[model samples]
Target: GSASGGPDEAVRQADRLAKDAGAPASGTAAAFVNAARELGMTRVSLATPYDEAQTETLAGYLRAAGFDVVRAVAGGPASPAEAAGWNAEAQAKLVREAAEPGPDGVLLACTALRTAAHIPQLEVAAGRPVLTANQVSVWEALRLAERRVREPALGTLFTVLPPVRG
Candidate 1:
């Protein structure tokens, strides 16, 4: 992160990962916001493993996309294996600690965080729409999933609210 934390480089990397994940591209915070708002969201928080500067730049991009930046959490361990195994109790505590109340959508980011399992509970605890890295991953590629894959365990988005009519 060049203190500058190249947004272009970051987006390029995200684009490659989206391809690898079999997801659509537009692969930046703006793309994310558009897709999310498609599902009725306006406010979001970030959860990622980066130094402060990189996290802030991401926060900036989201804001540019018209998303309200509720919070920007920086640095979680670097990979999915590491993130998935994170103590749920501890992670919950961290989320509670880092979270700041706002218009009602807490985003549990980090494509590696494997947070779907916790979304429902988090929403109950936080009292809002809870978005996670994996959820967004799927939403960003509903067209790819092909058949309808909505389920209660997936969070309010698929399990509950109607998808954005665009």
Candidate 2:
């Protein structure tokens, strides 16, 4: 679910809803931040399938979580249908271009874009982590479930995630 007010409020609201439902919830922005933190990334570049306004909103959320937004580029298909049509090469190009000039990592912030297969390649080119929403979401879910997995193909995150909290 998208944030209604702001990033902090969205996190609080998600916490309340999760408490009410008696289940753990993983908000995408929160999960992204946590994964970045776990990887010790301070400076980040953002590449999104959103338009400028939406992309800035996502950057705002990341900034609120204390990441340094060193660069942000918005391109690619903003809609789900268009994003679904985007291929691995296209996603790689976007992430690689966004990571220029050296940030600690790049964040691909759209769940609609297929990114898992390209993460390893992108990280190699960027010489830093390339985190996708779907990737971090799954990592956070597994962490919340107390399941430990180390899938190197996913990117550095999979190989270096902090130990599960139990």
Q: Against the hidden reference, what TM-scores do the models get? A: 0.68, 0.91
The number of clashing residue pairs in model 2 is 0
Model 1 TM-score relative to the real fold:
0.68
Off by over 4 Å in 2: 161-166
Candidates' lDDT values, in order? 0.61, 0.84
By summed lDDT, the worst window of 10 consecutive residues in model 1 runs over: 1-10
Best by the TM-score measure: 2
Q: Clash pairs of candidate 2?
A: none
Q: How would you encode candidate 1's per-residue C-alpha lDDT over 46-103 as one tens digit per residue?
A: 6565557667877786776577888877755456677666665645655664466664
